[model samples]
Target: MTRLGNARLVLDNEIRPGGVVFAGGLIGDIGEIGPGGDGLDLEGDYLIPGIIDLHTDNLERQTQPRANARWPSRSALVAHDAQCIAAGITTVFDALCLGDIGFGKARNQTFEDAVIDIAALRRQGALRAEHFLHLRCELPAEEMPEMLARAIEDTHVRLVSLMDHTPGLSGQYGDLVRYREMRRAEGLAPAEVETVIAELQGNHHAFHAANRALVIAAARARFIPLASHDDATETEIARNAAEGIGITEFPVSLQAARAARARGMRSIAGAPNLVRGGSHSGNVAVIDLVRENLLDALASDYVPGAMLEAAFIAAAEGAIALPAAIGLITSGPAAIAGLADRGRIAPGLRADLVQVRLHEGLPVVRAVWRGGVRVG
Candidate 1:
């Protein structure tokens, strides 16, 4: 048995000083520190459940670090996995976009390559962190239906999120002027940017509702979990609930998040938003959602490390207790994803754990273990 003691244990819903015993990749026992054990001592550092990220686009960023640069797909996959492990995420849902909205052709390539690369790496026992797919479906894209059809059958896909990035509708376009400026900064000529924006808006008007229904139907047929992205109003929340979407990935306003909570759907806030203190596009702040008790979980979104950091940050800000803060990234996400075997320090659960130390009021990951074996 592998035993760890003398540490602050972050349990499912509480934090205390304790230890745990493990064997055969399962938590065998959890309680006060034993007087004698063969395993290593934790030395009073904070030991929390390994983070489970339900949605993250860090892999896409790794695959295409910049506008004009692209790394080898397989190399990017390995780097992405390593980064996840180092961030103390034992289970990761790599959120890859399935539909292109004219931003970059490379995104489609990255999606295809990521699916193949992840499967190959997992089959070869080359991945340190558990990898799963979160399909991000862009409802306005004409090719979205075909793209979803092509990848929905993949065994690794466990979650699908409906996204509408139509300018003046959702996501980065919540602020049209800012969105236009972003496109121009991407090196697109002013006229070209306006033309593309017009085309996107037209596509949204013509296809969003139909494509959203199709994607929802596809997810329902497969029994895959469904998430609604960047919901901005109570109407969107009500519509999503009526359509049986169980998770709200990023509600953009307090009213939307409250509506989701009232509908019994989980509200996921981005960890990066909490870490940065506000939304990049001037939407509702995550701290505000926490204050209102509207946020149910926190996703890494784009930064894997943000999961761990945000938990500590939220706790330090006194918005919630540390254990409750940890739940936003750990038990909260795992439960949202329907993962029952991991995400907490409990007997008979998967032995996925992280050792963290606070330095100057910031949590720093010191080590990680998945399945009772150190991997980072």
Candidate 2:
């Protein structure tokens, strides 16, 4: 048995000085009382559940680190897995895009390569972190339903999100002019942006309605949890809730977040938005959602390490206590991801844990353990 003591155990509701014991890849004993058994000394660092990242685009970023560069898929998957483990994420749902509007055409390639890569790596025991797929289906893309159908037939798809990234929609990219700016920022020439925008602006009307129904039906048919992306209004939330979407991903306004709560759907906010204190795209502030009790979880939309940093940011801002804030990255996400065996510092659970040390008010990952084995 391996026992770790002299640590602040971050529990479901509070943090207490305690110790944890593990055997055979499961938590064995735990307590807030002082330790008596011979064990490793933690020096008062915090012991938290290994983070559960429900939505992360770290793999996309890994595959295309530069504007014009695309790395080999197998190599990129390995790198992405390592980055997730180092960030204290044990269960990583690599969010791969199913279809692209224009600028993110690389999504098609990523979607094709990642499933094969993950399966191959897992079979070889080459990956460090546990990996799953979160298929981000672009509802406006004409071929998205087909893409999802092909994806679910082969890969171990865990979660699916319905998205409409077409300009003039009700969500983040609604403004056509701002959308043009973003396309240019993605290394598209002005002429190319306009050509793409002209083709896409009114096309959403033709494809979105049918695509939404088809995608939702597909996900439900497989019993995978569904999330609605970038909801901006009560009507949108109501519509999505009616369609059986149980989670709202990054509502752009408090109205939408409140609507999500009223409809009994959990809300997942971007950790980068929370840590940056506001949305870079002018969406609802995550802190406001926290204050209003509209937030259920925090996801690392782009940056993996932001999960740990955002939890600390939430705690330091006094909006919530440390242990509660930590849940945004751990237990809250685990619950939504339908994982019940981990995400808590209790006995008879998977020993997936992270040791974090505070440095100048920011939490730094000191060590990470998955299934009672130190992996980082």
By TM-score, the best candidate is: 1
Global lDDT scores for all candidate models: 0.89, 0.88
Candidate 2: stretches off by over 4 Å:
32-38
Residue pairs with backbone atoms closer than 3 Å in model 1 (clashes): none
Candidate 2 clash total? 0
The digit string of per-residue lDDT tens for model 1 on 57-100 reads 99988999977899999999999999999999999999989787
Worst 10 residues of 1 by lDDT: 34-43
Cα lDDT tens digits, model 2, 267-325, are 99999998888999877899999888898899999999999999998889888888889
User: Which residue pairs collide in model 2, if any?
Assistant: none
- The model with the greatest lDDT is 1
